[model samples]
Target: MKKLAFIGLGNMGMPMARNLVQAGYYVYGLNRSKGKEKTFQELGGQAAESLSYIAENADVIMTCLPQPADVEQMLTGEEGLLQMNIKAPLIIDFSTVSPSLHTAIETKATEKGARYLDAPISGGTAGAEAGTLAIMCGGKKEVFEEAKPLFDVLGANITHAGPAGSGTKVKLINQYMVGMHTAAVGEALHLADQSGIDQSLVYSVLSNSFAQSKIFDRHYNDFISEDKDEPGFALELLLKDLGLAGEMAKESNASLKAGDLVRDLFENADTNGYGKKDMSVLYQYVKQQED
Candidate 1:
């Protein structure tokens, strides 16, 4: 088993790291927060003293960060992965960053005798906890193959999207659909409420109808129905992904009519104090618009 360093231990990374530890891989968990590191430690994973410690010790480094800038600083900053004394370590980034940034990091990693893969993931916090995420990877075929065992422990639907930056491309596409579907679910539920239709009846009908989706199932059942406001996947985070999607569209000169519209809705929600709430709170945001 290769020594693995799992960084960013946030909503998705913590569970994924725990899954790796449970699978008998010796994982060095690195997080900026001491509380999160303690949580990871309680899961039978060792907590690293610093980024340099993992960079020096681990054969593979996996990061699930919040933004592209953070990923850049972690990989190329003064006290970053590039500065560490390591021999050919593989860096797998699970953060949803831009293709251009992905390419830049890949180049830097290659120059330092390390491999980098843009392997952004989907399926949300539930999927991360269950280890059934859809991981879209972009890198050299050989490196991808070498990383398969680790990916297997973290994801269920892992695919090699193409060369460097392709995974971020596919992930942006995935996020585009996710944004639209989330907005659609909210709108449909709002319409149903306005029509005096029972929420349960609407859900039952939609579950058998062509309008049904995983987003509907998860949002309605796990959140909207139970009134759970916790952050399974925060609205602010979704907004970030939507912003990345918009960036991807602009770079490729692609039209994102619906993407633009739904992004505004999410932006509104984020600005209106629902940012920290679960994405299912979109339904509440929509409902409040009428009140």
Candidate 2:
């Protein structure tokens, strides 16, 4: 049994680290946020003294941070993974970030005789809570194979795309599509409600017709039926990921005007105080227009 140090105990990370513990890994929860520390401790997990402490103690390290810069700081900063004296612990980064950052982290890990896996996830917070995420991963074949079972415990679909950075590449594509679909859902539902039709009637028709999608099933109905806007995935975070997707596309010389267009939609939501709402709650943008 490996000693796993799981970092970032936010909405996504907390449930994931808890899943690993339930799966029988000797896991340490490394949360810099002291508030989360007590919650995790209440659940019977130990918190390390510092990042360097986890770096020194963890045999398998996984992080679910928010950005590439945070990932870099975790891997190379003063209290970073590179500063720790260890011989080849497998480090899994579950952050949504650039492929270049993935590659750069792998190089740094190599210098310490350690290995790294870039695994950005999908399926939202509901998926995270249920351990049903779709994990797209990039690393060496052997490393990916070794990590696949653990990923399977956390997600429904775990695919090894290629070498380091490829997972982030694939995730960028996934996020672009999700962003477009979310904006479309918002716009279509808005128009449907304005047509003098009952919101439930419109939601049901669209959900059963060819116009339906996971977003429709999850939110269109929820919006009409309950006005539920809990954070299965946050709007602000989606905006951040979409922004990263646009950046990744530009770096690859790929065109993603659809991604760019939706980026603005999400950005507008953030600016209008919908940042804290669930990503699906972008419907509020349309609802506000109606009001």
Candidate 3:
């Protein structure tokens, strides 16, 4: 088994690293924030002090950062993995960054005699915790095959999405639908509230109807109905992915009419200070507009 370095112990990363530990990998966990290190330690994982530690120690380094810049730093910064003379042969990035950045990082990894995969994921925190995420990977077929055992520990649906940037390309498509669906769910629920339909009844009927989705089930039952705004996936993160989608669309000369509108809706919610809240809070933003 390749010794693993799991970087970024946030909402998604922590659970993912824990799952790897549970599967009996000698996984070293690292994070920018020191607080999360103890949580990983409790789960039978080793916590590294810094990226340099992982670079010098592990054979496979995986990152689940939040932004493109962070991913860039991991690959290109002064103390980045590429700069280290470590023998880690594989790097997997699960961050939902741009295809161009994925390609750039893959090239850099190649120069350092390492294989890189842009393997953005889905299924949210629940999926991460459950070890059933959907991982779409872009890299060499042989490298993906080598990584399959590790990916199997984290995801239910593991697909090789062609060349270096295809995983992020597929992920942007997923996020595009996710944005529109969340917006649709918000608007539909707001309309139901306005029409004096019992919110419970609306959810109950939709749960059995063709209009139902994972968004409705999660938003209505878990967070919105309970009036909880604790972030599962934050509104700002969705906004960031949508912004990336907009950039991808422009680059491909594709028109994103619905995507643009949904982006603006999330932007409005973020601007109004709901950015840190769960994306289900988009319902509250939609409802407040009519007040």
Candidate 4:
């Protein structure tokens, strides 16, 4: 079996890496923060001391960072993966980033004799913990086939979207709807509150009607119902994805009229200090807005 190095042990990455370890793979878990490595070690995974250690030893390197800049830095920075003399590792990224960035990384990987798959994931932290993420991969079919077994351990719905940047393209479209639907849920619930209708009744009815969505189910049941607002998927992260989606539309010379308004909603919520909270907290922000 090939040894794997899993980097960025955050909300999504930690559980995904843990699933890999539980599946009997030899995984070296690395994180920028201090204590996560120790936690991963306790879960029967090795803790990587440095990127150099991973570059020298890992046959497959996987990263699940938060931003495109972080992904680029981890690959191209001083003492980063591409800077080291690696043995042509299979690199997989499970972060939501721009397709253009994925294309650029693929180019760099090809130049370095490394294999790359842009395999951005959906299904949030709950799905990550349950090992049921939907992984959309973009790369050579042969490379994707080689990595499919590893992906199987991390996701239930896995697809090879196409080559180079295709996976991110699909993911961006998914996020586009996610952002819009999230905002709509906020508006619907706020309307219910203002009109003296029961929010729970509204959700129950919509959940059975055409107004239903996975986002509505999750946001209401997990966060909004209890008023918790923990970061299952952070508002700022969704804002970032919405921005990426808008950029993608612009690049394709397509118009996303409603996308602008939704982006502004998220941006306003972020600016009002709801960025780090659960994306469902957009409800609170929406409720505060006046006509």
> Which regions in candidate 3 have their CA more than 4 angstroms from the true location?
none
Off by over 4 Å in 2: 221-224
If scored against the real structure, what TM-score would every candidate get? 0.98, 0.94, 0.98, 0.98
Which of 2 and 4 is the better model by lDDT?
4
Name model 1 segments beyond 4 Å from true: none
lDDT by residue (1-291, candidate 1, tens digit) is 689999999999999999999999999999888899999999999999888788788999999999888998898877788877865799999999889898988998999999989999999888999999999999999999999999998899999999999999999898888889999999999999999999999999999999999999999999999989898888888899899989888889999998889999999999999999998899999999999
| Lowest summed lDDT window (length 10), candidate 1 | 79-88
What TM-score does candidate 3 get on C-alpha atoms?
0.98
lDDT at position 52, candidate 4: 88
Across 1-291, the per-residue lDDT of candidate 3 in tens digits comes to 678999999999999999999999999988888778888999999979677777877899999999899998888788788998868578999999999998888888898889999999999999999999999999999999989999999999999999988999999999999999899988998998889898899888988999999988888888988999999999999899999999999999999998888899999999999999999899999989888
Give Cα distance to truth, residue 187, candidate 3, Å: 0.9
* Count of backbone clashes, every candidate in sequence: 0, 0, 0, 0
Q: Model 4: how far is 262 from its true place, Å?
A: 0.3
Structure candidate 4, residue pairs in collision: none
Query: Once all C-alphas are superposed, what RMSD does model 4 give against the true structure?
Result: 1.0
**lDDT tens digits by residue: candidate 4, 38-63:** 99999999999888889989999999
Model 3 steric clash pairs: none
Clashing pairs in 1: none
